[model samples]
Target: MKLSLGEIADRFDLSLKGDPAIEISNLASIDQAVHGDLVFLFNSSHRKHLTDTKASAVVMREIDCTDCQIPYLISERPRLTWANVAKLFDPLPMQAATRHPSAIVSDQAIIGAGVSMGPHSVISAGAVIGDGSTIGAGSFVGEGSKIGEHCRVFPNVTLYHMVCLGDRVTIHSGAVIGADGFGFEPNKGAFVKIPQIRGVVIGDDVEIGAGTTIDRGALCDTVVEDGVKIDNQVQIGHATRIGGDTIISGCTAIAGSTRIGRNCWIGGAVGIIDNIEITDQVEVTAMSLVTQSITVRGRYSSGTGLMRGRDWKRNIAAFKRLSNLFKRVRKLESERGD
Candidate 1:
């Protein structure tokens, strides 16, 4: 879909700074953009490339418009504006209402109007799929599960029994919802299996990335609130509650019964311990290990950046000696008359 600079600015409520007639067909980075393509500049460090870029139109902040050679759209947040405009060119695929011949849909399942069942998909008994939802090829909607309106269960995704998903939820390929949590009891020198009786509850507009696993609760529901974005390979443990608008990056492990507050940003590879409460608006840096509850809203980090093995060993030795060194200093101070 091609649009002139004027049309784009009008649609996105941005201000046009250059020739409004210039047309743009696609979006690209500043370094890779060419004529007829649109590009965006967000960081001030990349401003030097603006003079040499050949993009027909650029989306940027009003302050960065100076000396720019191309027709541009000025916005307060250029990156977000670029995302909104890019959607105009790349729309989501429309699924047809018909079910494929190879799809196996149980007669006991309650499927709503306009639902699409792709080839080899399975809809089990007592399942309820809401209006306009799409079950992609090879996907499985387990028995008694309830999926809400306009949801997309991508190819090879699995929704286990009793799982509930709200409207517009998207589960990407290879995601497994309602999987059993890791639970066990010691019995006579051996580990005994503990029953996992609860399910998963996902709210509206949540997107679970590929290969992510959301475990079923041991006794109560594991909940993911509205607008939560969970990246690939994330593990959400049983009975955990993640608040609205929280963004958790890839490879993060959230242990059981944890309560994460609203609008929190959890970076990649973070490990959050069980039963901890993280306050609202907290930011957990990448690779940090959270061992206790955080009551304050602030940036919390606990991990060492890259360092040489020899230097790291020396730093650890120094850290171990600090307690004795402090004791010696205190003793000397106490003995001094002044």
Candidate 2:
């Protein structure tokens, strides 16, 4: 995985500030880097450590190079350059294009060229796996499911019947796609379960994190558009359509029938209620509860900031008297009127 500084600079369109022949064998943090390693300084506050770093080379902005003693590559966006560099050092092995002996593939299933099936994986009847895809151990691809080219379905992932995934999608371990949505009708002191008959359709380049679950729609397909990144343990409810390029952080819960717009950022642990429409480019901060539709695009937050217990108690008391205080102020203004 070694790369010369000149090669990295040319590939990433970065400016070379030092000897181009210097070879980088690995990547490490600025603090932990040894010789033959490349480090990056993305944060300005970390510039203080540049003078003392032990790395052979560094990736940084031109302004930060003044304090760097080692060979460095200049980039307008150092963090993004570092990300591209990290891909060169990715440790995951390439797919071998062979199925394990223990794998159970249905006779009616269509497996494409260069596909790899790991141990005990199942491909049900009428399923179609695209070229160069990898199905990891213990995964289950249900009947009529279609996985697109170069997708990776990690171990223990479940794609329920009729689910469709687009090209280059990555489903992490323990992810369950197209499970039944929660729908129950109240009847005479009892609850009757409603049938969830729809499937899920995921677009290209989407990465669903570990343990995340996307439920099938009750009447329509649950859709996730291209380039959406969903973090670990997130729950996307039935018939919800997440627009392209939305980023949903870990533990966020989006209720059924919600329409989230493009380029939106949903922070960690945010709760979005059912049937709400969130406009494009909206940003919902961490732990905020969204109960209504957002008509305008902007950053929205609804939660108290962290504070000491005693200060919180005082604020709660003041909040409880707000209505009465408003009434008293109105009366005082009425008496003073000329």
Candidate 3:
């Protein structure tokens, strides 16, 4: 989709400093942009490329356009404006309401208008797929599942029994929703399995990334609230409640029964243990381990910063001798006492 500079400015409420007639066909990074491409300046490090950018028009904050030779659009939030523009040019295909020849949908299932099913996709008995939803190739919708309107379940995705998805939800490839939680009872030197009966209820506008797994609850529903964006390979355990608008980055593992509050930012590879509560607007940095509850709303981080290998080894050696050093200091203090 081609958009003129004036239309973008009007749509996004950005102040137009460029020629309104200039056509923008695509988006690119400032350093890599070519002719007919729209570039954005958000980071200070990328400001060096502003004068040399080959794009037709640039999007940047008003303060950064002083040295810009080319036409530009002024935005208070440049990155957000860039995202909105990118959405206008997104090239994802829209499938019609047709089932592939290899697709197997049960007669007992209720399929809504404008729904499409790809090859080898299966919709089990009592499954309800809402209007304009797409089930991609090799995907599975298990018994009693309900998918809301305009949801996209990408190829190889699995919706286990009784799973519920809200409107405009997007589950990428290989996402496994409503799988059984890890529960066992130990008796007589052996373990017995505990059945996971409850479902997973995902709220509206949630985007779950590829290869993510959300386990079904043992006692109640595993709930992911509205507008939560989960990055790839995240593992959310059973009965965990992720509050609305929380952003969890890649490789984060949230243990069972944890209650994460609204608008929290959980960084990549962060480990959150079970049964803990994190309050609203909390931010946990990457690689941090959350072992206890967070009641306050602020940024929290753990683990040491990266250093040279030799320096780390020296710190480790000093850490090992701390107890011995403390004992010697105590002895010296006792001898000095009159």
Candidate 4:
């Protein structure tokens, strides 16, 4: 998949500032690029590494050409152009409508045209697989579930019964969708389990990462709106409604019955408790615990920032004295009034 510098420039409509005959077999980072590799420079902070890069060519703005002695393509958005070019070098394999003999497809299931079911995959009874969808090896599509067009259920993924997925949804390996939510009632000094009868509804273009689990609700369905990107190891509890275009990072845990608004950015390892409403465009910082409802639209963070050990100890001491200090100020004000 090697491409000449001139060909790339002409394809992307970028200004060519170097030898047209130069070729690159692969794309790489600026620091790790070797001979015959393409690199990119977007931030000025990375300009220091440009001189040391051994790439055959680089992609950068025209102004950066002054410091770069190597052949480069001048682009308005170097990263976007580089990403498009990288796809050319490493294209994904196409999956056709061929069902592997090892796959188990139920006669009762309705599979559409151009669907690819891989080896050892199971399409349960009464399930509907839309056209151009790919069920990867060892995956399980449960009974009565509906998978929409062009969806990709990656290897070993499990979509439980009654789960619904929209078009172009990508579920990665080890993801468990429509599992039972954790529900119990204290009855006669013992915990009684509640039945989870709800399904999971995933909208179009939603990409769920590996090992993520989206639980089924106790009564209502768990709804994830379109264009949501969920990262690896995320745990979403039952009855949660995720708005469109929300990006959730890795290892985040959201409790049950929570409503996450549109275009939210939830950082890695963040914990959100149950029954809280997060407004639109809210950005939660990494590792923060959300204990209450976020009514306004803005960035939010909790816990203390990184500090030296001595400074942390001093802060802890001051926190302990805050209540006493408040009382003392109140007493002083009362004496002044007297």
- Candidates ranked, most accurate by TM-score first: 3, 2, 1, 4
> What tens digits encode model 1's per-residue C-alpha lDDT throughout 166-234?
999999999999999989999999999888999999999999999999999989999999999999999
Q: Over the full model, what C-alpha lDDT does candidate 3 score relative to the true structure?
A: 0.95
- TM-score of model 2 vs. true structure: 0.96
Cα lDDT of model 1 overall?
A: 0.93
TM-score for all predictions? 0.94, 0.96, 0.97, 0.92
How many clashes show up in model 2?
A: 0
Per-residue lDDT of model 3, residues 137-241, tens digit only: 999999999999999999999999989999999999999999999888999999999999999999999999999999999999999999999999999999999
Error of 2 at 38 (Å): 0.8
Clashes of each: 0, 0, 0, 0
Would you list the clashing residue pairs of candidate 1?
Answer: none
Q: What's model 4's overall lDDT?
A: 0.94
Ten residues in a row with the worst lDDT in model 4? 60-69
